[model samples]
Target: MEDNGNSTACCVKLADALMSMACMDLQLQSSIHLCASDNRLVPGKPLSPGSTIISDDGTFALGFFSPSNPKKHYYVGIWYNNIPKFTVVWVANRAAPITVPSSAVFTLTRSSNLTLSDGNGHVLWTTMAKSRISISSPRNTKNISTEAMLDNTGNLILRSLADNAIIWQSFDHPTDTLLPGMNLRLSHNTHPLQRLISWKDIRDPSPGPFSYGADPNNLLQRFIWHGSVPHRRSPVWNNYLLIGKYMNNLNSTIYMAINHDSDEVYMSFGMPTGPFSVLIRMKITYLGKSNISAWTTLYSEPVHDCNIYGYCGPNSYCDNTDAVPACKCLDGFEPREEERRTNNRSFLLGCRRRKALRCHHGNSFLTYPSMKVPDNFIYIHKRSFDECMVECRSNCSCVAYAYSNISSGIIDDTRCLLWTGELIDMEKGTMDGDKEIAVKRLGKGSAQGVVEFKNEMLQEIQRLTGQQGSR
Candidate 1:
């Protein structure tokens, strides 16, 4: 046990050398594989709860986060990393959340799939819906190396290193917000129509009743639907470069682009570029309204509830130009239930025909200019003014018709739209729209009908257009 000074120094050097060699061996082992996060994971290396991967630009981060009721469920999601608020944009286990957070692990499996599993190996969620990688047989394992990246634009991509191909992307499947570069496809050859559905509530990310997308039957127009019912419709696209542009509350320009080809027809939004930093998103709100919101302020498409579908009921039109938004009856119509009329003369019971129509008698058409056309229209192409008039005149069921000479890009340029059945969700004084509708009504003295006016405004409007001629 006794040692000289020189011998003791030599022993210390030997110990130091061994320690250095072990540290070098550890560093080499770490360099063998690449990880998505700083504490990256390779095959068999999983991310337990509370771990995360941040984007290179630090704009977004992917991690496991819980909602308001943390004990109920936990989700693997992506959110804005730089913002003060935790705004989640993408969710991995949206439909099936992990009920037990402490027992969950998010991992890239040996089969090159991103999966979430419990401690007992119960698979909770996975990106295996369209995986192209091959699974290993009994003796051999697949060595396909994959990496997860959160791109600067907030896209989470699982990429294969072998051939540099993306296995899956978060942009393809959106929950609520429609980012700038994401495409909202109206029609696709192989896939169903793509849309953005709102969340169930502020505390829950479940799919809500509100949805925003293109009209499936007519791809030219976009619509916001409330549980399969059309709520609000966008103006038909003019086939121009910019479909619509608005200066958001944050003083940034947000514009939408329309693409139409033989394969697909889609729309995508764009934010202001160059020097300015801003993010804009189009979202369907839980209350069934489509809103384009920025970081600072939110702007709604249909500003008033009267603009919503069927708010004013059938045969009546919502008038938003007035100081107080109100509904008005068409010429020669009265309130369906006159007893429900208030002292201020507001018609809560919609409208009904003042004079009942006889199919055998001759009827006249009344023209109303600058109006938002009603819903449930039948489109007929290649029709002139006289032909459109005859088309409606020939059928006793045709109640109204509107004509528009759309630009060439649409399916039919010379468009004639006719409406039958109940005329629900109409609007008057729509300055942005430039179409006129001709409605059929019985001629004066043709039936035992009495005209009743609830208010002076409606009575004055009836007097001004009562003499309108019909062909």
Candidate 2:
């Protein structure tokens, strides 16, 4: 009976020991769960739903999100953590959204790549497994460890723990929003350009119909495209470093600069560097509008619908000086269909020259200051004003010529643009008023010098005004 009692005591001791171990295991799991919510993501650790990896500064968060409530689709995206409005800046699985949000897992793999998997262990999205560093030995490559980190700049980066070299970064592959410090590549001699593609809709993170990027054909300008067609065009870069400047609520100046290098050209914006710096972003809307928004709307390009590319058609310009911007024919041109203009129809018919060009007979150039130069220009390098005029005069097909002194140290000192055939996509009195100089072809006797040209144009304008007053 004593031996049986001892066995029972042993059984109770074993049960108590098992309970302590179970409690310790649960505590370890709870600690690991807390660590998973921090900025760094190590290999073997997976981030599931309801858990987010925030940036070190707590400015951005990376996690699974469903755009709408009754959640049918969910995507892994990075967004502002501090802001009340959840604004996603970058999306990882844009093309493939997970139907089961609860079953989704985002993990950094042993191979130094980030992988997103669905419930059934099917891979949804993965970072390209590209070696950023050269491995001297094959064995060393296998031993290299990696971790994924979310940065204060809203960039998700995967880096090697061995050398801390970046294997892949989300900033290199942008979505709709362009965060400050992210380069929008304008021109590259060899590399393919990157574009900011809009979301399919408010509820869908898939690529939409609208895209914003540099014009492939023209390196000096940018375009907002609707599929294959240009929806709007930015003013040609005048080789100025500062393209845009604005002020925030804090009275800090936000500067957008276009930087040039020997091999590439890119546009990037920056806000004041401080602890109280506000978030600034440029985003392309699903409907094809480009907006620069802070807490409130700061600026939007092509402010009016009439500012759309080719809206005024050929041989015309969009006049934005008035309260409501409207299309107007160039000085020497008139509407092709007067009836259409009067009936409030579209200007797709464009404009026609009031008189046909008679080459070199009595041709003179009419200066239109503060204008946006039309598209499809033939750029002539290093030409003086007189030389530019002579070159245009020599060509019978040349319709108009514009000359400007860039002197911005990166580009050519002088810009001599010659236009032939029809002129398209011109604007007047916009933000780039100082950069453009539109000179039109008119009647007989070209001016010999800049002073002479301005004088003659002034007298001609006064004469026209006098004639109108008398009538």
Candidate 3:
């Protein structure tokens, strides 16, 4: 219960003070320091470079950990407190875990900033922050009353007890996990769009090849990027929601919900109400596939089979419920190679066009439904299905189109995506399932109606003239 500085916040825990005690009461009387975990540090006990300093509220924890070798280097990290089986949501020194024992420590300076330093006082990692109120010359934060905390919602915040203001928070600088209320925004408006980057490997906490972000071009759908290519995609948004299908077997329905506030729009998921509380999370695996898992089940996932992204390659479909192992091409489409061989040993080479299109006035569209549509599409603003059809037919460059009615309050309150060239990584669904797409087939006879009309008119004129047969 003391006011040493003019600031308004209180320091909940001090590493120097806490290290002397085995446990301490978290309830602050006049002191305003407030993180939920009770942690103790000792001079002889340096946390073994692998344990944690958790808050009293069971919200966040600070610990030295490694997903890889037990005897290897250790990274300072923050993770959700209640979730079972350690899920490291944020890492302070992702690229620089401490290799040597007793060589690292986490501290808050006098100016209220958090930094991780090695034995020789070399800063391996630090949080990015700016002062809330400017001082005369930006005073160096020597030992200001600041602390690192993990919140109930899974945000690791670097805050000052002197003023009750957040200097920096992990919500703004996420590594891979995107909780219920976090904004994945533009880096500098000129960078190549910000995204959720996964780990290089399960055991390694470095940046990986897979990243998830909203499509900058349209921002209507979420995309999974591998390098710069479309690795996979979420369902196109409709009214800020995507309710895939009601599964009678699962006995549980899953759907996406979009929320918009003063700054950004974020997406989250929910399940049907039941006796068991179901919590869902999306994790992008090292093998480059996004998986959705439920908290209530032991190991039950709706779509964890073989068909995802382009696992089977282009134009090929994987039938999940088939008796023997299922992967095949559509009726009119043919495999790229005929002698490629059997199911288990062969990969999806995709389907090829049975016949070429003239792109002339004699083409017609063949509707192929029950599909998981292709990638690389641009959305057309506020267009109806019939209008979309006309627009595609009028343009020779356009190859395929898909439509979803979204009241998203963006341009037209409707979503219409178009593709110009190749159809890659598609699949077919069953009559009862919901991964349906309508594939358009443009053939030479596609424009036969207009051609037949013109030919008929020419013949009539020839008959009337009686000598114009050659023309």
Candidate 4:
């Protein structure tokens, strides 16, 4: 509580306190010392008494504080000093709270780990992922870069001058909110992938339902999973061939950007030219929805309806910015039921054509403009628009095809995406994407051929994956 009581102009005193805390633990008595907040965050060991960890901009301070009752217990967390609110992004001791408020000390153990322990010698918190493998800075970084800092991007990092690159960050091990630069990948990197797990309760920082990330099995799309089944799914990347249509919309400009660095690929959206810039964030809601939001003068609404996953039924789409509701059936098709009303409503039983593809004769494609493609598709790289079409059509089972050039300064000039089978969850977009697609329409005969083709193709897929087909 007295950490912030000192004068504003004071310095070096806090630095001294940090160095003094290192003496509490025998293992850290030597290498543990303090570095000022300039380029380096003052550090001793994580929980040494008198030592305080501050963010680079001083927007947040990391130190010991009690969660609710400060007089009886102490917790190590990061919070804002300027606001009337105590916004703790991370808490080092969430499960264990010191009872006696005994003289607490945080030190790097002989095992090369930073740990928080009671003055009576009780370990409460630690930074080691696994206790079996002793923590080591092979380069002896902690002795070099010296301080662990919370950077401006909300990343708490440990760096050494020897290798300035980030060694550890809280982003990689998310507690609740997904911060920028965090890759929520599958722990197994295979089928039955995981998603971003939320917290158990509002205050309790434990894993909850509603994890979000790309579906490894159906990777052309991102999904929010409630345990195992898909709670919600993003517009499948269906050859989402280059949807980069950067337009100068008033002040804030929205452009999709993608890049690769060190074998990791990521994409981020930006509004580079905005006045009094505000936070534009996206999150997988607890109720299972992907929301893209920006801080308006007063309230925030879905920037576009297409932002919601599965707003329209399969082979149908949401066309926001239109006078009517954003739902529209894909071209060359109509709702299957005779009782179908031409209005915006959410329903599955996707559109069916008056012109049935009987697989008896001609097959043609009806092109749609400014459309957010469908889900349940595959990615076929290095294929031209025509090549992609042929790949789907020759199979006879291939139902539809959507191709994007991706050459609009984002992806390969010749990169193509191909789709087969039923088209689901599509919507018309503000931008027509960079190119168009050709959907093959089958006559009654061709339709029958497609059904047979699909059966045989399913067999090959099962064989390839070494899965037994149903008897």
Candidate 5:
């Protein structure tokens, strides 16, 4: 009887200890679940359809989202948490959406990858293939982990927990919106550039026709393209730093800046950091329009039809200074008679030169001040004003040339642009000041005329300098 009682007592103690351990394990798991709810995802913790990971500041949220129209296909995306409307900034599975939203799971694997898998164990999207995460672990033991977090600036970052190094981020893969602090790379020596591609339509988040990025041929300017054709073009970057500034109603200054390094040149915009600072974002819509949003359209591209690229056609310029912007031919050109007669003022047929050039005879250049230099120019480096003129004059194929001293704090260089063929996409009174000048070659076959014109240009330069000094 004593042995039996001792055995029973031992069994009871063992059961009680096991129960205590079970409760402690449950509590630990409960704490982990709570921690996962707040802005982060660790290994083995997956985000479901209804659940979301909000940013630390509650400014943005990352979760599954379905566009309003179909309401059937769901995608993992990041959107504004503070705003009333659901404005998605980035999408993870843009091309592949989940049909069964409830069965979709977004997980951060131990390999430091963010993956979205469906009910049947099919991966709709993953960061594993795109990024290579190097996690150090003990010999024969795989215990390394990673986490994904939504940042306050609307960036979704995947980082390794072992060393806390960022493996991948959503800012580098923008869909259609350009949030503050995000950059549009103008030039890079190695890394592939990113483009903001508009969604297919209002209801679909797939790729669209309109896309915006830096011009591959020229890094000095950016282009918004409709398929392969340029829809709109931004003004060339003359200065290496601050491009423009805007003053909001709250008296905060928003600045657009271009930054350059040894290997890269990128453009970004930022506002003052304070309580008065409002949420500002630039989005390219599906309808091929770019808008800066701050509860209102602060800035929009293609403000008028004249703002479109090559709107007035080749050999002509859009004159925006008038009450109604009009297309006008260059100084030594005239609109084609047939097209002008078809639509009296449209000038869609472009223009033709008034006379033909004689290469053997010397020519004089007609200078147009305060003009936006034409497109399709050949850039010549490290050339003086006289040298640029001689370069153009010597080349019989060169039709025109423009030279400017583009000496800024970051770059001390000159812009010597030579045009061999017909000039395209010129604008008048567009530059802020007398910054851009376009010189067109005229068929004046006199050597004395060329020398006299050069002297006149020198005198004009001195006069402009004197006026600037007075300022």
Candidate 6:
């Protein structure tokens, strides 16, 4: 486990001369200076654009790197140093990229502030002192010693020489990826929720529309939002020490945990440390897919396009049990007017009721099994099966109802979810729980010929629904 925000409060004490000693050891062994591996930037020894500082374990590196094309623009960032391919984790000046690489200089000022500036002394980025500390005027403090070091965990920290007082750190300002030992704040009590914003594209490190973080409106659930709309969602957090433990292709287990205390509530996931842990990263790709991958078998969530939020439009259910996941109309429903053509290949417009329900004529519930409940549902509580059924039955506006005793919580043990409007973002075979939904529809007796066709269609639906449940 790791601490939050100011990590030094609980950080393991390391000697101030740790970086010097490490550099000295390397010099003695290799007799190299310019290309030597020294994990710190001491005052007066400004780090140029070409040079880089590697973590003690050499697992990560901090230096200037360019995305898209190396000659175009350069940004100071931390990346996996040992990996064959350049995989950056965090960027210092994301919006501001230095065009001329030769003019870039990363140095520590007399005030112990780490600054990334150009040859003309134009400050691109800086880790300035907090409010309490004063650095109003620059002074030649020959006696003062300050240095910046890259820790083994890939965290870049700037500390004072007298005492290891952490002035700033990279973990406090995360970019896209949530590395191991990273704390993602889930509440705004102490600070705003920490979110992971995806890169604009493979070539651009700028911020994109996709972001993953705690839902402010509802603290219980986490969402992957594309702009303002949710793309994928995680089940409500129940303050579990361990929510899920998934095994990767490399046979390593990744665990997700919900941790909290008096001050903060947050979620973080990590794999086992030591040699067993391989290089892995959880990222939301530019195309809006959340993925967890190691060197081996990494998979993306919402695997099918049908699983995407409302991809099949309103009143349509995505069937993933089939050879190919697709959308289809529910029973007693047909495609909407303009989309009713037999030649229509896409179900983008979805479906509408074949015969509008008449409350006076009486309607019946058509149970659909193995379902991922539709969005925009009202979660009603403390209701039995009969009570839940009546709750929807009494209301003419209620289109569907789903009852489940899925939660162990005291408040909403029996979930009686009711849907009033058009059902969107519905899918089958992807639900963790095999919950069935009963849709309210017009009930009418069919003739002999129509009865045979209806029975056959019902049998096929049951088969597919059964597969969804089993999946």
lDDT of each: 0.64, 0.71, 0.55, 0.49, 0.68, 0.67
* Per-residue accuracy of model 3 over 154-207 as CA lDDT, tens digit each: 566766556778778877777776555566663233435557788888778888
Off by over 4 Å in 1: 1-45, 69-71, 134-145, 233-252, 272-278, 338-349, 356-365, 384-386, 408-410, 429-434, 441-471
* List of clashing residue pairs for candidate 1: none
lDDT of 3: 0.55
Better model by TM-score, 1 or 5? 5
Per-residue error (Å), model 6, residue 99: 1.1
- Model 2: per-residue lDDT, tens digit, 1-471? 001000001111112211222111111101112222678777666888757787875567787776754457888898765543567889999999998777789987656678999999999999977755433432343444777899888889888777778888998889998998788887888978989999998888899999999878766678999998999998776555443544535355556667787888877776656433437788999988998876556888768778899988898788888787878887788889653547542367678888888877357676666677888889899998678777787788988887665545656877788999998988888464234344546655645434555455345446534544573
Model 5 CA lDDT for position 193: 81
Which candidate should be chosen as best, given lDDT against the real structure? 2
TM-score of each: 0.74, 0.82, 0.69, 0.63, 0.81, 0.73
Q: What is the C-alpha lDDT profile of model 4 across 1-471, one tens digit per residue?
A: 222333133122112211322111111111122222332342343445444565554444556655342244556655443332344455667667666543777654544355778878888887773322333443454543334566654566654444565545565655434433444443232324334565444344345576667666643456667777665555544232223333343244444334444534444444454431223334544455544444221112234444455656666666665766556666667776732764436545666665655452267555554455666666677876557656776666666666543322334444445566667666555532312345667443344434443344334334423421221
When 2 and 4 are scored with lDDT, the better candidate is 2
* CA displacement after TM-score superposition, residue 359 of candidate 2 (Å): 0.8
The window of 10 residues in a row where model 6 has the poorest summed lDDT is 1-10
Select the stronger candidate by TM-score from 1 and 6: 1
Model 4: how far residue 419 lies from native, Å: 3.1
| Count of residue pairs whose backbone atoms collide, per candidate | 0, 1, 28, 25, 0, 0
Model 4, residue 246: displacement in angstroms?
Answer: 9.1
TM-score winner: 2
Q: Any idea how many clashes model 2 has?
A: 1
The C-alpha local distance difference test score for the whole of candidate 6 amounts to 0.67
- Per-residue lDDT of model 1, residues 1-471, tens digit only: 111111001111112211222111101101112123542344565677645676665555677666644246677887655443457777778777777777888887767778898778899888884665654531232554666667767787778777889888778888888876777778889978888988887666778888999888886567888888888876544333332334543345566666676788778886656222324567787777777754444568677777777777788888877997888888988777662456533455678887776664366677766577777789888986557766876788988887654443635756677888778777887533434677888864332221121132234334433422220
TM-score of 2: 0.82
Cα deviation in Å at residue 198, candidate 3?
2.7
